[model samples]
Target: MSESSESTIESGGIGLSEDALRTLKLVADDEPIPDDDPGLRDLRALHAVVPNTHRPGHWILLDPQQTAHNLLWRGIEEVTGILDRLTHVPKITEALTVEHERGRWRDGVGSEYIEHADQINARLDQIMASATEELLTAQPRKRSKSLLTMALPRDSALLERGCKMRTLYPYSARVGVHEPKWMREMAKRGAAVRTLSIPFPRMIIVDRRHAFIEDLVFDSSPPHSGWYVTDRPVVEWMSMIFDLYWTRADPWSEPLDQAGRLTNPIQRSILRELVAGLDQKQIANRLQISEKTLSNHLTDLRTKLRFKTTYQVVHWWATAAENSSALELRDGEPFPNFPGTEGP
Candidate 1:
């Protein structure tokens, strides 16, 4: 056979190998081939040859072209059936999804516990890739440089697709070296970045439909285990929380603008915690700042105000003009009035 013909035969044209074709050809010429040959079994399987009943151990070869035609016709039918099934896959998947979601509203809510960092990242990527409306994230603590690096492209793509992105970070994050750069880059890409002095729960909300939050069971650890929430009520509540903080937050444009005020929001938060009877370490932990950084703020306050002790600072903060109003951290929740201040 020519090279092209052999190529066709090898490509399942007739579902017969070259060896089988050769065996068939030999049988057609009445050549005495071995009865136990492997090609003989293949030729028989393809119906390309039949046993000669009158001549024991002899075979009869059918027309190769006819055998090829029959085999190709059957293959074509199988392929057509597969194509028909392939066309139904998307519709079938959609129907199954609808069925799975049936009565889910009455079932209260749906949540998944993602137990690992990689899985959480993958799920977020999947969710963000299809997000159309907005993404709201509250990161109370500073993010690692590596995590920020990995998220830049994914976030930029979300912004490029016209998704409104807003992120909330603690005031301490603004002083970080790498995080500020990441925040600035994101802000430049039309993302609304803000910082709050008050501590808030970390969460990510996509399109106001889904939310991801820390498990709180592992909040003291470094792993990224978390909960994926799809309940409309729960997600809406988280979104509301984010909006409340965002309302009181300062924008990324002015990182350290005092506005002629003596203390920044972060310093005010430290003072607030101090007046609430928290020690230096506890205040630092709550504000997501290091103890050293917290001490620096105190030292700066003491030096600027010409005071010698933290007690003096707290004394002044209680009677300060700014602490008079109720500090609203959440809906209907406000800080209690200090000793020298009046309630709202």
Candidate 2:
């Protein structure tokens, strides 16, 4: 080869350094190269130059083309083997996953405790992505607008796949600027969203086969972890709980009006919580509203009903519970009209 071509090979066109190319050339021409020559190291490493058994201290150069061909052939074989293994990876993984899932099923231990919020979100994405039949969620706490915005694309994708999605939120969520609009947008996309006046636990059920719920410690104290559950009985029970709440919740699109009642949904929820013997702070927490907001709602209720004090409000609530037949009566639907309870 010409010097330039030899230089190219030396510079890694073929991984043969310039000195190694020189050693090769000398060997090819039947010229003896010194054992300690600088170029001999590269030639020896490549195995292109070998010891001459008949003449000690002498080296032989194999045909370069054949040597190149051999290297190329070996490389091709190695890469083909890697490709073949890569092709089978999915099958092997799938088989192992099947066995793993079955073992968990048989052992009645199909739950994973995830501690971090980010990890929980990631697992939720995976669960939702795999959902083909239905998605159900109950959120007892209010969500930030940013969180709702982040979930829009994923929820939209689920709806687009023709999967049924149902979500339940506290009635206090309707007081937000973003939540009602987000709920309506999702409802328009064929998702069923409802607001409940009563308290419920946070849950996410996919296909009625898998679920995620809050994790509690051995002492029944919350550790801020999540349990990803696939246990059949547990998941089924959770699904039923969701269905029970869902049936009683008011649809997102409908205004909370029951025959032109005076109290709205939030006020009714506050009244119910008060009737349940919850203090202002506890009522606010359960209804997913601030204490000030809860107090404001109570003040509005008092003004509307022409009551003078909180005691009178609760007293009337108790009396109405017994005598008001046309009223909400259950699950905190908007209160129906009483004979003299009309307000502007």
Candidate 3:
């Protein structure tokens, strides 16, 4: 690798430099492709390390995995989640190491208590760079675009390394302008980005061996200012918490992207809330859309369902819930079918 390639993170054959390539291995593109590079090229085939179009010196892989990684670092990360989506990985975590292990700390718990943001950031970068197998993360708050952008390189390295990773976010994250778009982009690169309706602490677990937990109770707390735990039990437990949420999370495969038309989750949310017997105002408040917006959504949904009144929509929803547990609602369908519900 040249100094230019070294300037950014190394994909390490795992494209640990490119999120999509993290699942792959790579070699730098040169004046001409080399045979040894060809041997390495098998892994790099799926990814391209884009040279800086405007700046000749700088180069990067257009990491697809960084989409989820983007927000995980937002609001101080919810890492692969808050993975810093600490959207934890279930396959790797399910098998916890049998023995209790410790780290280089004085307590030998291998844990570090970091109160400063800069120290936390530096340590996280160091640990993530060292991760060999997987990255699990969570991001509790809606992330800003700038934070997501800054995180691309770090998160992309994990993907490029082919390290397994997943990210967790609030279901509400879908409503954000950036979150939904980010989730869609990242999910394509083998980053498992899921959103939960419930609450979770901001965390990032790397390889299920090391974990970062922010000061969850205090919003005023500094970024990356939290405890770093290496105790196997604690890390395992955090990973487990992530799994519980993962089980309930809505995987981010959208309908229009797949085969549907009613593309908004908020509309589906409204229908669900309506079935729960909440009025429009309540449904709007619960889903965090404005009543006017909610009213418009209701109107649009009604038009799609071809129902004349709110009662008919509710009736169809209730009937669908009762009849076919096998039926699933889709965005493309005129009326949505929930995971276990029937469609009208």
Ranked by TM-score, the better of candidates 2 and 3 is: 2
User: Once superposed on the true structure, which residue ranges of model 3 sit more than 4 Å away at CA?
Assistant: 1-113, 170-175, 180-189, 195-201, 217-225, 253-344
Q: Between candidates 1 and 2, name the one with more favorable TM-score.
A: 1
Q: Return the top candidate by lDDT.
A: 1
Give me candidate 3's TM-score against the actual structure: 0.47
Q: What C-alpha RMSD separates each model from the true structure?
A: 17.5, 18.1, 30.1
Q: For residues 49-70, write the lDDT of model 2, one tens digit per residue.
A: 8878787767888887978887
Candidate numbers, best lDDT first, in rank order:
1, 2, 3
Task: Summarize candidate 1's per-residue lDDT along 1-344 as a digit string, tens digits.
Answer: 34544544545555566677778777878777677776786677677888888887778888879988878887899899999999999989877665454334224357876668899999999999999999999999888899999999999999999999999998888888688899889999999998888888899999999899987643333467788889898888778777777766778897464556678778888999998889989999999999999999899989989999989999999888767334424235544333456746
Question: Residues 96-183, candidate 3, lDDT per residue (tens digit)?
Answer: 3211111223245466667687787788899998899888888877778977776666887778889877898766677777787777
Off by over 4 Å in 1: 1-108, 217-222, 324-344
Q: Rank the candidates by TM-score, best first.
A: 1, 2, 3
> Which ten contiguous residues of candidate 2 have the minimum total lDDT?
321-330
Model 3's lDDT to the true fold?
Answer: 0.61
lDDT-best of 2 and 3: 2
